[model samples]
Target: MHGHGNVPGMDAASEVGVDVRWSETLRTYHAVSNELEHELQAGHGLGLSDFELLKALCRCCAPDKGTVLMKDLEAEMYLSQSAFSRTVTRLEKAGFVERAACGFDRRSNFLAITDAGSERYLSAAETHRAVLDKHFG
Candidate 1:
């Protein structure tokens, strides 16, 4: 009990609703993340972060400008810059994305998804959506 009220089965820490809610949120996130990682890898040969990076780029792809700069995508990604860069490198090696120097900026680089990436993303998206629907629908 939190010393505020008695919760039948919980100790002081877990007795409070706020504490329970926070823990449940963390639990749900982990469950979803683990499943996503597993299914993406098993079915698509892609990691969860890899799928997410591809998803972000695909969503933000402009009709005129299919490329998006790292800075522009920084907000969409949950990883640190170094981690994101590493993901990009892995995707590039897998032939899913291309990293190119910006035409007008020396220090800026942009990412463009390949045709293969688009096709892969199309297949993986169904898996991603199915998982989300099962968990949160």
Candidate 2:
């Protein structure tokens, strides 16, 4: 009786494909995330989140001359503003980022990545690329 007792309720079979795809996607994302985190930690003593922020900064058009605004990062990364703010604060404390008032917008603060931060990011990125190539390619 136990073997057949747990049939999923109405339309369950039809929806199973959607559930499977979502689960698979999550699994793949987790695997990639774990690899990235491990590589960053070993290569730069930085967390995956820190590496992401640095990458965003390095990708900025005016990295050396100005800060990347919080709103821009939030939009680009799809992070909540408060989450971005907390991560920025962590980077700032680690000497990987600096905050300054925007020249054009007093209400906006720009986050700039430091030289050390850039170097660390490059190293971790190299490691991450290697891992992906080895596993996925």
Tens-digit lDDT track for model 1 on 1-137? Answer: 23766555565655567778989999999999999888889999999999999999998879677799988876799999999989999999999999889989989999999999989988999999999898999
Question: What is the C-alpha local distance difference test score of each model?
Answer: 0.89, 0.77
Top candidate (lDDT)? 1
TM-score quality measure for candidate 2:
0.78
Candidate 2 per-residue C-alpha lDDT over 9-117 given as tens digits, one digit per residue, 9 for 90 to 100: 6556556677899999899889988987887787778887777777777786383474678778767774677888888898888887888888898999877777877
Instruction: Extract clashing residue pairs from model 1.
Output: none
Q: What is the lDDT of residue 26 in candidate 2?
A: 94
The TM-score leader among the candidates is 1
Q: List the residue pairs that clash in candidate 2.
A: none
lDDT for predicted candidate 2 compared with the true structure? 0.77
State each model's C-alpha RMSD to the native: 3.9, 4.2
